[model samples]
Target: MGARLLFVAALTLGVSGLAAAGAAATGAERCAVDDLERRVCLEAPARRLVALSPGATELAFAAGAGERVVAVVAHSDYPARARKLPSVGDYNRIDLEALVGLRPDLVIGWVTGNPEEQLETLESLGTQVFYIEPRTVEGVAGTLKRIGRLAGSEATAEQEAEAFLDGMEKLEARYAERDPVRTFYQVWDAPLMTLNGEHLIGRAIEACGGANVFGDQPRLVPRLDDEAVLEANPEVIITGSDEESMDNDWLGHWRQYPNMAAVAEDNLYTVPADPLVRPTPRFLQGAQSLCERIDQARPGSGAE
Candidate 1:
């Protein structure tokens, strides 16, 4: 009787294990909508992936899919490990042959940064592509969650997204009622470019209680002359730099116009380009630095 009871217990455990294995084999499919409103579905969590832009690469790693990235475009240097991955080419132009050879399960594309024809061609080749372009702060968090969902790392992605939103909320709460500072953020020097309120950077300025001088421009990134900047006479001028020290002299040209409020008040500043320019979770660090600079420029803030 004792031997018979032990046999029955072992058989029951084996049957339970088989049932669990069967359930695992039929797990639910993963799907998410891209920024362009196109739904991408995967039969299984992407085991091999290719990121077409530096920002996309960063987003993938942030979604906890870093190890699954088989290939990335140029300048996907964040997370340190990404730099060691294979490159298919730059964001604008892809090495089709190389990319196709990798046999990635999913390809992460950039909406504006990638060529439309190339992406279509990639799709025609039976490759699944998901495009992303986050225009707002909330959009950034949403993209993180979506990417995480498709990558089978939803928990990590959700945590990162929540943390980013929390940081932004804290910033808004801290500076929402502060005195507004007129600001002009220079995107480029030659053919002088500035972002309108619709751009993510412009939104960051608004969050810091800084009024964007070019926020009313019709174009997202509008070109203007030095005369327009002089006319605005912003209180602070900020730009981004790729260097670690943020010591670029892009704002030096404005110094010659001492009559300009930003020049006169010496409120010109620079933030790290990667964090500020890229729509990623790390943007919180850039936003914090920007808010601090804007705060220092406020009256009675005691800046030398």
Candidate 2:
């Protein structure tokens, strides 16, 4: 089955499993698999936590452990309360002393974003670290439940996860049968980057019934020149911006190529950067917006 269908199938099975496991599970032991496929276990539910990335922080909060978080890395803003917490440093350069001083029983690390040496040092200091990198929408839900398990907030986490999965299922059902629209998603302006099918954003594009022009690329995020994008000539070109209004002119750069299908059909669009980029429950909202935009680009949907 496709990854999207697999997600729905897994969710149906996982919910029942979670309930049965929760009934049988003991408070003395907590275990979950990290993105690295490593089994991380805690003797007891964590009482104090530290998040190493903005996305990790959001997941922790979504798991109903916001009050347990002792520290967070930079840009951990969201849920309003996270901004008030102490900062250990940014994800790339962590301040070991500050983090250790917080006495966090659990440290949430970013698999690809965090510094490996720093994480090792934390482990050497006897701190339990859980690394996460959710590449698919289902991965995000799994991470949420795992964090909830570790934080002793399984009920809340499971509810939020179920809600997210349900929303995604609805989106898939709504768009899955629609005619596909060729798409190219711009990740960054400088160096010009796009995500491949393995990336979460690319997967979201597929869920919205849109085909990523660079989906077959080897790299998760590939850098290319303007000529390559011009050559792809996608039907719908999309980008994200930090600005809430998404008023930036990043997509305007495509205007020079009037012959491009996306430009010719005026199918260039932008969505909020945080919801789409972050691996959190808020991604559901982002996906909804994405599906709507792609629907507009469909030939019979009236954009033509």
Candidate 3:
């Protein structure tokens, strides 16, 4: 806890200092570097913005650019207001005519989620696209700042980013040094999928002082069979439910394997899928819940 506190303190101070310096240097035009390392510059704050992915929509709103978002893709349903926005299409397919009709001054996109050809077309049509892909916990915070910079909402964005960092620090302080437990996080059950170390959920497992049994898998999301899971025999098994109201049937399926360590100990758990899966501010809430669950499964925690 002490070491993590020190690290978080250093990180928060460094980011806050840099953000202030960067804000002071801004001129008439606002510019932000995207995930691709491409600089996107706007002559003024964008009044009409289109978000092509759900996560991007959430991020734009988090940056206090909600009113500026004129359109969003399907499933960009967060902040309650996003669902009411005009939809050009889903992440896979976009209606070019509808998108153009909206006269969006800026388009927020996902580097890996959105279709590449469509994004290129939008850029070719003179639309400014800011691509975001947050691969790490800190990267998520940085994305808010960049999004705010592009939208001319730096002040609000800075506050949200700092809040997220502080929440993460609290979770880290509470769980980072706890006794390590072997964990298996199931992403899906049809073919039995799990995340690799590079994925956010895998990092969440590590953050809670739990080791992802399949963290070394080469693929970001790997498919496995029951036999493979039995071999790994993780001490804890966790999965996410699509909504808070839904039951986690996937976790219950493993009960058939009575000899499996997690099944034997009944350490299976579920978290809200959207918060945990989405790389947005709500992720902090999800991570905290996960850490508490893992702590309860620890040797001296008095679990069944």
Best by TM-score: 1
- Put down candidate 2 lDDT per residue, 197-281, tens digits, no spaces: 9999999999999999999999999999889998999999888887557786779899999999999999999888898899999
lDDT: worst 10-residue window of model 3:
1-10
Greater-TM-score candidate between 1 and 3: 1
The TM-scores of all predictions, comma-separated, are: 0.90, 0.89, 0.88
Cα lDDT computed for each candidate against the true fold: 0.87, 0.87, 0.84
In each prediction, how many residue pairs overlap at the backbone (N, C-alpha, C within less than 3 A)?
A: 0, 0, 0
Candidate 1 C-alpha lDDT tens digits along 1-304: 2454345434534553454456458885689999889999876787789999999999999999999999999999998999999999999999877776676768999999999998897776567899999989899999999999999999999999999999999998999998999999999988889999999999999999999999999999999999999999899999899756877777998988999988898999887888988999999888988888888778776442
Q: Model 1 scores what on Cα lDDT?
A: 0.87
lDDT of each residue in 1-304, candidate 3, tens digit only: 2454345434544543454455556645688899999998876666778998899999999999998999999998898999999899999898776776666768888898889998887676566789888978899999999989988899999999999999888787878678998899898899899999899878888988988999999999999999999999999898888774758778878999999999888899887888888899999988877787777678786432
Residue pairs that clash (backbone atoms under 3 angstroms), model 1: none
TM-score quality measure for candidate 1 = 0.90
Ranking by TM-score: 1, 2, 3
